[model samples]
Target: MTRTFRGRVSRLTAAALLGTTLLLPSSAGAAAPFPYQDPALPVATRVADLMSRMTLDEKLGQMTQAERGSVTAADLTAYRLGSVLSGGGSAPNPNTATGWADMYDGFQRAALATPLGIPMIYGVDAVHGHNNVVGATIFPHNIGLGATRDPVLVEQIGRAVAEEVSGTGVDWDFAPCLCVARNDRWGRTYESFGETPDIASSLTTIVTGLQGPALGGPASVLATAKHYLGDGGTTGGDDQGDTQLSEAELRAIHLPPFQAAIQRGVGSVMVSYSSWNGVKLHGHQYLVTGLLKGELGFSGFVVSDWNGIDQIDGQSGFTAAEVSAAVNAGVDMVMVPTAWKNFLTLLRAEVGNGHIPLSRIDDANRRILTKKFELGLFERPLTDRAWTPTVGGAAHRALARQAVAKSQVLLKNAGGVLPLARDNNKIFVAGKNADDIGHQSGGWTVSWQGGSGNLTPGTTILQGIRAAAGPTTTVTYNQRGTGIDGTYRAAIAVVGETPYAEGQGDRTGSMSLDRDDLRTIATLRKAGVPVIVVLVSGRPLDIAAELPGWNALLAAWLPGTEGGGVADVLFGVVPPTGKTPMTWGTSVTQQPINTGDGKTPLFPQGFGLTY
Candidate 1:
């Protein structure tokens, strides 16, 4: 009889067991009445249960995301803030992976200590590897990856980046910028995959790589498909300017990538700061709700860009009206960085007044909590320190090297100057970018608008050249190309734009080679060595006049950290496979040149050379 009874009890369903267990005292000697605490329940059921128990304050808190510097751990608990983030360049005092983990754990601790014990999510702009943490592997920016035209490679890079991020306890990444960059003059052009929606749409494989097969798996992160609806087609190639394209053009040029990302089950969609047809995206109900959520079937929460709501009324600061509009428009999460307190106050007041409906509040909380539950935040909220060592690991760096090699576009290999013989040749390397790791990595490195000179650990182009050279080869370096002589078989002048991001990088004037770069090439030319120009830039430069003088030209579009990849193609270790992701304009005047566009470019889209 005892054996038969035990057998029957063992066969009970998990829900039945959990139901039976809830009747008894929990380990903490308290009643576990909430069904949300049970891991076996469906995410939607758990979200509903949790939302039912939450107060107005708690619901609003889940929708607020404050920057790390703006709020303390104690404040996180006091306000029941749902999320925290680190802006570019923002880091802990130690600025190590461990430090970041500790920081994240502290905030999470505060969040869990709240009445209901909901864990808070932390986000960062880990666009290129775990960029905020020093010593983290910095992969080449999106422009470089776009040039590769290899979705599989880009996806692998995303997985590696997710691993590093998970090691540091950051669960959310504002990455894989899906904008179809229409104009090279846009300062944020490098953030785009290519000029066409196809390139960006193809690269949506990164969404799978980031989140993995499922959300709760190890190395899984919440991938964001960002800058929704026509940020890339702005007039005058402006950063936050209006995109005056017709609805058809917007859907054709910018919507496909987002559709692909949605199909891949992207966890979040961030609204763009830019406007569409003289309307701010942050307050655009049609795009955010009617289009992205309704038509696209995107169940994931929509998040506002950093302080994006402030610009809805062309204002300097956000107001109650802005909050109402943004929330009503379906921005489930607000990145109120520094103004979170004010935002919360306004949001609460607005909700109380029925300006922002309680249904919308519940909807936002439901969406946010669903992700938190799916992330296994309740079961495992702290950092997965086991992944810590993967940061800057040899395997990841090797992968980065491969990506860099694949991204190298040989624009002009005149007289087969490239595939340079590794042995018995004197090589002279010169220019600002040749030996500078920071410059090679480009913006969104350790800091916001990444700085130059050994800011982080990585092989410089000169270092790679020397390492790849044979025993008999001698490689000499001079930043200004002053030491080159006629005896050298070839001179490599690696010069281009220094690090800048967003509006600061905008080029309204001439996009010609700088005076310093021209001078460096002139110095090398005077020595009678065949000048090989390795342009380390984010976008195509106007080099039509200077192209005639250089023997070979390589567009090394911001190859981060692993400069050996650049050297790989240079010395024929790897073949040049990268095609021009953007149209190489004949002059700066042909600003919006694209593949099907009427303007004839210096190097058409898909142009590249091999050994």
Candidate 2:
């Protein structure tokens, strides 16, 4: 029995007699039109109307962002959660593009089923391509991209990454870590574009690539400028350490990149876990609200780093006081992860006690809902499956290869030892990174810390060398450099750090090559063959003492997935054009060295050799 509203005729007269209204509200309530549901209303008008109708619980939910593992669909609907995120390595059982889409859709359905029908946004650390997904193209980390000095190429990579992310139903990317790294020993050095603010500023083109000219465009995703002010300038290069800089120094070194990001219309800013002097950024109202939102004219919402609120009082876990402080400080979205329920309870109590203002709560919801409206989530909130096939397509891989080639900085090529003949010769490839895709990709890969050896599908440098070799040439690989002999023309020792991220990767002591790498190079040196050292590292390693021993050297800064690009420069298919984005210090003691700092470096910034 179908009953029609408006001008349409109803087949079920009996149902009509029951006085049920269909499309429009009955004549009694006709004077009050639902402006929020009307597509013709301006976005601002719609947002206001929707806010006017939301309850306190719904508004609080809109301010919260829960991790997927801790929350279920039932939880989302019951609490009206506004967002969900898959932490690094958090994926569906299958972990395929379709599997992700299904998971996202299920959560989204639950979110929409709430009384207000607000769609929940999903975020992931897709910092370097759709990194969490298997079979997705992995581009070089920011340090490698910075070496390329190609903003246009970076924008293209951003667009490709956005497409892949959209295909999987994720709407937000916690990316473009705009921290201007001041020290190489920082575990997150690879996340930064370079040490200087100029590099990070110039690369803001990635913002436009991710968001397009406007929000809600096809394939557009929310972009986040992260670890706001002084995170990269921490004392002693410690992860989540304090930055003991004056206001002027902080503005000079770390603030410019975020200013550039704001100008690019980036949708969100992430608060840093690190502190300035002694004040934690999560609770710093002056910076989060007064500076970024007020002085910088940023209209976007601010998100807290993963469980960042817990560290406000240097505590192991978060307290009600911490929650109140963070919310009052203008963190619109709280990434509580596992403790989201506790966060909600604390926040509600705070608000009820007037420790947190209703005005602040409304402001947070307004900022978050505005972006959701701009994203057109109400109109189209599901995964755009059409883009799924582009995840690890050949074209993206080709672009990655090109980026890798451009990122290779040839530090030394003494006596023209490179461009090794491809035919009628034998090449020896040795060291841990020579044949491992994961080793070259570095951290923030499929998993948070990443792993070694064929962790994902990609071309290894050894495979590229063999593919580029002529029919008469042979390529042999021995990870430990044990099989090298005088018969080999040259020994390519690809050695460097394994995968690590954040606090786990911070090195407070020696920053030089490991003993195993030195031994491997020594083994190749014993063979009496020309030794070419390729360093696959996140930052500059202390290798000045070993420089004179190698015939040639290439700084391949975490060239992800496409190892063929490294081979291209090695075989002369492409000229070395990348420059060192960070100054290579002569020793570990010169930790904070930079260009124009008066101290001599092992290699200056922008220094690279040609073929």
Question: What's model 2's lDDT at 453?
Answer: 83
- Residue-wise lDDT of candidate 2 within 1-611, one digit each (tens)? 11012111111221243243322222223332577655456878988999999999999999899999999999999999989999999889788888888788778867777776778999999988899999899999999999999999999999899888888888899988998888999999999899999999999889988887788876888999998978999999999999999999899989999999999999999999999999999999999999999999999899999999999999799999999999999899999899999999999999999999999999999899989878767656666677778889899999999999999999999889888887898999999889999999999889999998887899998888888889999888999998888999999999999999999989899999999999999999999999999999999999999999999999998998999999999998998999999999999999989888999999999899997
For all candidates in order, the CA lDDT equals 0.89, 0.88
Model 1 over residues 457-495: C-alpha lDDT tens digits?
A: 889999999999999999999899877789999999999
| Candidate 2 to truth, TM | 0.94
What value does the lDDT take at residue 216 in candidate 1? 77
* Model 2 spans with C-alpha error above 4 angstroms: 1-33
TM-score of 1: 0.95
lDDT of 1 at 8: 13
Total clashing residue pairs per candidate?
A: 0, 0
- Best candidate (score: TM-score): 1
